[model samples]
Target: MTGKKRKRIKIGDVYAIPLPNGKYAFGRIFKDAGIGIYKYIGVSIDDIPRVEEYQFIVGVYEYVLKSGVWTFVKYRPFKSDDEAFPPPSCIVDNISGEFSIYHKGEIRSATKLECEGLEVAAVWADNHIIDRIMGVDKWHKDDEK
Candidate 1:
């Protein structure tokens, strides 16, 4: 028998692995050293790899070991569409106790801004959503370091 070299994982290769209740899951490979850890996310439980890497793209679904069910989740888009970043001139206006974010229009929310270019209304809409996933007061605490 001719022995072949093992294949290497890439950014978009999908894998399937066994799961509980005779089920399986699917996950894609992704590497991002910035996140510091690698794991499957959106795929099935059966597809997760028992290895180490920077970050792996996971499917937003999982296999139920006991019930033998597949549950799909509403996952955010894996790829970012925008390649350009806003200039540093963006600002959030604070007047007295009221805070308004002005981009193209007035923003009306109270969450920490990820960037300052998103309009007030857009930022306001994002605040609650961002807060639920990552706390409300999220910001760089150690920028000076």
Candidate 2:
């Protein structure tokens, strides 16, 4: 019997994977298993409505800065023609030299930690939220502290 050829996938590579519902999702390769088996965390392609080559979205938020403390009130998207602004995907707060991830308007205070860890956690949280909204399984779990 002839063997089927497997596609090569590498870590950090963004790919369009076929979903179970006969639709495709855009996933970023998270792990590379030998023999073409890979573990990926993907968001539905429909989630990213606007695709731009080089675009940065500036968020408009009402914040109060007093006594060196900044409190964010709400987030609003800026009007733009080239890109469609979605709701605030994630909020990275750096207060007192600690980073925290804010999801769905709630501060996950326990996640506050060093910058490196916070960065990873923030991305993970954002991806998790997007996947949830799109009805996809979460690819990563929060590391136990």
Candidate 3:
């Protein structure tokens, strides 16, 4: 055995993310690597935000969680009615900075205007996602130069 204990990461689990300004952001696991970072920024973990609101839903780089960068807060059951966990239908290519729509496993070209509010098709690491969430850096596919 490698002797490293694996933290149980499960669907419906919420995590407390610390921002540089002292406010906390929350992320919920909807599936393996699929997490929704909530739009609600709170003063502390005790301030539970509603699960319905979110800033971005992306496939997070698992290492960030595995390394304990984001602390587990609580678990709320995933619901059939939850709209925050939708698979990314619109995808932006990071290298080429192009946009596409991916739905039902099919991908097709999409205009930049059509990709509004969609994240680049890449797993977000800790710093990148946190900066985006904290408004330290704002990113929109159409704004890419």
Global lDDT scores for all candidate models: 0.30, 0.29, 0.74
Q: Model 1 clash tally?
A: 12
For model 2, what is the alpha-carbon lDDT of residue 67? Answer: 17
How large is the C-alpha RMSD of every model relative to the true structure? 15.2, 17.5, 5.1
Worst 10 residues of 3 by lDDT: 1-10
In Å, residue 123's CA in model 1 sits off its true spot by: 30
Error of 2 at 45 (Å): 11
Compared with the true structure, what per-residue lDDT tens digits does model 1 show for residues 41-123? Answer: 32444334454332312112211211223222112223532311111222445564444433222344444555444322222
Tens-place lDDT digits, model 2, residues 32-135: 11011113323443332233221111221112111112111112232442223222233444455444544334455443333333223222322333344356
Candidate 3 regions exceeding 4 Å error are: 1-6, 81-85, 92-99, 103-117, 138-145
Candidate 2 colliding pairs, count: 0
Instruction: Please report how far candidate 2 places residue 97 from its true position, in Å.
Output: 17
Residues 1-145 of candidate 3 have per-residue lDDT tens digits of 1122337876777888888998888888875367888889989866768756888887788788777667887877776634335465577777997889864346899999877766655678889889888776665654786
lDDT of 3: 0.74
Pairs of colliding residues, candidate 2: none
Better of 1 and 3 by TM-score: 3
lDDT of 1 at 69: 30
Residue 28, model 1, lDDT? 34
Worst 10 residues of 1 by lDDT: 57-66
